[model samples]
Target: MRVLIVGGSGYLGQFLLKYLLERPEDEVIAVGYTYADENAGPIDHPLTKIDRCRAFRVDAATGEGMDACVRAMAPLDLVVNCAAMSSPGKCEKEAELAMNLNVPTHLCRTLLEHNQKSEAIAPLLVHLSTDQVYDGESPNSVEDVNAPSPVNTYGRSKLNAELHIAENYVAGRHVSLRSSIITGSQPPLRPVSRPLFHDFIVNSLKGDEAVTFFEDEYRCPIAAVDIVAHIVALSKLAGKDAKTDWLMRYNMGGPDRLSRVDMARQTAEVLGVSDANVEAVSSASVDRGVISPADISMLSNKLNSLTLVSPMGWKDQMRLALGMAKM
Candidate 1:
């Protein structure tokens, strides 16, 4: 199988690439604006080589180098979009730029056309969306029943992207995965990418003074490895025989429903530190430019009923995440 991962340099992208590389039969293409430039060649890993694994620089926001990249990696079996301008503050400050990256119509259109040209069945397009699409007033239900009312520009843009792909692409060939805040080790190549909420908590544990985390803000903090696992599992089901309804959407969130402060306190516990070192603060005390939803935790009834598979417990996942980060 030939697989392509857009935004291959980002945090989730890198982790996905690493996890997928375990499959020797699948030739993976990692595309990013900076990955190619940074490595100056193919990415180096034990399971990956220059031949079967390759990298390309492409700008998904403007479609620059998209066609060329796609042509070179033509007949792709799957395309996973992990690209996004995920920062709420940044999205609020630069709405157009955020929209371009988050809801990239041109990029999706180009992929749709590419899939149409393929001799085999259409390539499965798996897009990663955020749980933030919900207003965060309560835990979000399955995609079918819940109406997305995003409170921030980041969520709005991600929701728009999800809708755009659903409306434009072939039904069974596209799937949107709505997930909570991803927590894991940072990719060594692109350390400059935006820091995740989990990172802040982990860093705070190492700090000398107490660090404040929002007590009211809640999310289902999923581990990066588990997210990649779900994506890979879903990608394997992409075909004419795959379930049509399942292809539409899914929610990949950890089972634990936790607030920011709770997550931090847990991290401290795992690190053998006192909870007093980590302070709990309300979101109201923060001066963030963006209006965040109070809670965007999610669970998928479809997956539970269909496969009986759910994300691993956040505590165990958190331990693995912290272990990987220390590596």
Candidate 2:
């Protein structure tokens, strides 16, 4: 199988590349813009050292290096889009960049043209969306039934990307995973740019100063590995024998609805650390430069029904993330 993972240098992208490459039959191609740090010159991405995968430095937003990438790896079996300017503050500040990076229109058009030229089946595009598309007024939001009412630029950009895929790829050759907060360890062979939520909680509990977490904000955080698993399952269903009329959008989230404070408490309990310094606060009190939704918890009934895989609860997810349990 030939796979193309856009934004392959990012956190979840690296995880997908590492997991998919475990299969000897798979040929993985990773493309991203930030392979090297701006201050560090042309340092190589650690994942580039992997023998089975080919890595390319391409900016999906500007369409630079895309044609060359498509020409090099045509007739792809699957294309997983993990590209996005995910930070809400950054998205709000740079709306244009957010839209360009979040939306996969350029990537889709390039792939569509190549597929048309080669006369091959369009590869399944497993795009990574966010649960922020919800209005936050409700919990366990269902796909399609609840109309998306985004409260921020990040969510709006993500929603637009989903719309593009749904309208353009009408044959059900695409899967838009509206994923919640993805928490896990850093990707192997990659530089840790920032601490993940799980790490932030753990580090705070182990430190001297009090750390504040939003108790009112709620999300169904899924382990990174589980998201990769969903993509793999969807990839297996691709091709002519696959179901063409199946649902295109799926809510990919963990089974439990938890807040940041709830996660911190659970992490402390699981890791046998003291939570005395863990502070619980409301989201309304914080001025994060972006409007954060109160409750974006989502139900993954559709994803579970399709993949036949049940997501782990918060505690187990914490354990897996902290390296207490096997992946």
Candidate 3:
């Protein structure tokens, strides 16, 4: 199988590239914009040493190098779009950038056009959406059926991207995976202004200043490994079965639902630091401009019912991530 992963230089994308290369049979092509720039942060991994894995510099946002890249990798088996300006704060600040990257209009158009020219079956497109799409009112939102009422620009843009694919693309050839806050071992190596859960925790632990976490924010944080496993399994299922059910949108939420403070305390426990190092604050304290949903813990039994990848506990995933961060 031949796979093309856009945004391969990102936090989640790096893990996806590593795991996919483990298959040995699959020829994976990872495309990222930062690869060509010298000043950009490092996206290199040990997996690049393998003969089957290759990384190319392609700007999918502008469709600069997509046509040539798509033409070269003509009959792709799977295409995963991990590219996005995912930070809610950043999206709020730069709505144009968010809409341009998140919408994925050009990328989808290129893939669909290429697939049309090929004799082989259209490649299964696996897109990553967010749990933030929900209004945050519903505790356990169902996939596809629940009407998404995103509050912020980031969520709205992501929701729009999902809607575009769901409405325009052919069924069975594509799927939009709505994921919750992804907790993973890969702590941000560079100085990230908008830190993720794991990055924020690890950075706080490594710093002298205490970090304040929102006690009201709740999410079903899944491990990066688990999410990547689901992506691979879903892709394989798409190839193995011709059923149109695989085309449907599904949420990759973990079984455990936790708050921001809970994650920080867990990280402190893992790091052998005092839980007091992390301070708890209310969502009302921040003037983020974006209205975050109180709870985006989605019920993913329907997704788990279809695939063998059962949702794992957040505590276990956090512990493993802490261990990896220390290494």
Candidate 4:
């Protein structure tokens, strides 16, 4: 299987690349962007750990290197788009850059065009989307969307891009995974997500240090491995064996849902940290303009029903991430 991953050096992408490389049949090709001038953070990122895969320098925003990406992995069996500008604050501030990087609506359109006209094998595309498309106010919101009333521009742009892709590229086999907050180990080493650093804040409290978290946001923390496992399983799920609900879309949610405060408390509880170590900060107190999803739970793991559970959850995953941070 010739598998290609865009944003292959990102938080989720690094793990996906490593796991995909484990399969003997999979010939994985990963494309990641890096700035020549910017201080490239962690040189030893998770993407660098992938054994059987190769990561190339490419920009998803401008389509600067996609043609070469396609040429390298000619006649691809599967292509997963995990690239996105998911930061609410960043996207809100830099709208054009965010739209270009966070949601590659036009890039996807280009890929769809290539898939349609190409004599080479048309690849199955799995686009990583978000449940944040909804305001997430309801306790029970399914993947079947009523209206994507995104509270933030990041969500709004992603939802719009997905809609555009669906409307324009109707012919190809594709799936849009709509899910909640993804908790994972370190994103290898990347310079992009500084404030979004998961390990530093969590472990500080767990180590009897001070911790502050927002109180306004509520979300379902899905494991990063859970999201990738579903994508891998979906890549193999054939039409005859696959169900109707699993056809073109599915939600990649987890077992329990939680607010930002509750989630931190649970982390403290799971790690046996004291309450004093955890501090509840209001969204206003936070410097970042991160949107608080009132409730971004999932409808069902109809996708997971066809697959297995990710061995790591937030607690275990966080522990591993902390270890990685130390390294």
- Model 2 TM-score is 0.94
* Candidate 4 local lDDT, 1-327, one digit each (tens): 667777776677767766765666544444333322243433544444445555555576787767666666656667788888777888888888877775666456656566666754456677888887888677656666545678888888778767766666544467778777777765554544545445555656656666677766666667777777787787776332222344565666777666667777766666676668667777667556666566666655566666665434556555655564221
Error of 3 at 149 (Å): 0.6
RMSD in angstroms between candidate 1 and the native structure over all alpha carbons = 3.5
Clashing pairs in 4: 45-189, 46-188, 85-102, 136-295
- For lDDT, the strongest prediction is 2
Instruction: Give all TM-scores, in the order shown.
Output: 0.88, 0.94, 0.86, 0.81
TM-score of 3: 0.86
Best-performing candidate as measured by TM-score: 2
Which digits, one per residue and each the tens of the lDDT, describe model 2 over residues 72-108? 7776788888888899999999999899988987888
Model 4 misplaced stretches (Cα beyond 4 Å) = 25-51, 170-172, 188-197, 206-211, 238-247, 281-287, 308-313, 316-327
Residue 105 accuracy (lDDT) in model 4? 60
Q: Write the per-residue lDDT of candidate 3 for residues 49-152, one digit (tens) a residue.
A: 44555546666568777787778777787888888888888899999878988888877888888867775677888899999889988788887667889999
Q: Is candidate 3 or candidate 4 better by lDDT?
A: 3
Instruction: Name the Cα RMSD for model 2.
Output: 2.2
Candidate 1: stretches off by over 4 Å: 25-51, 188-192, 240-243, 304-308, 324-327
Q: By lDDT, rank the candidates, best first.
A: 2, 3, 1, 4
Candidate with more favorable, higher TM-score: 1 or 3: 1
What TM-score does model 4 achieve against the real structure? Answer: 0.81
- lDDT value, candidate 1, whole model: 0.73
lDDT of 3 at 54: 59
Give the range of the ten consecutive residues with the poorest summed lDDT in model 1.
30-39
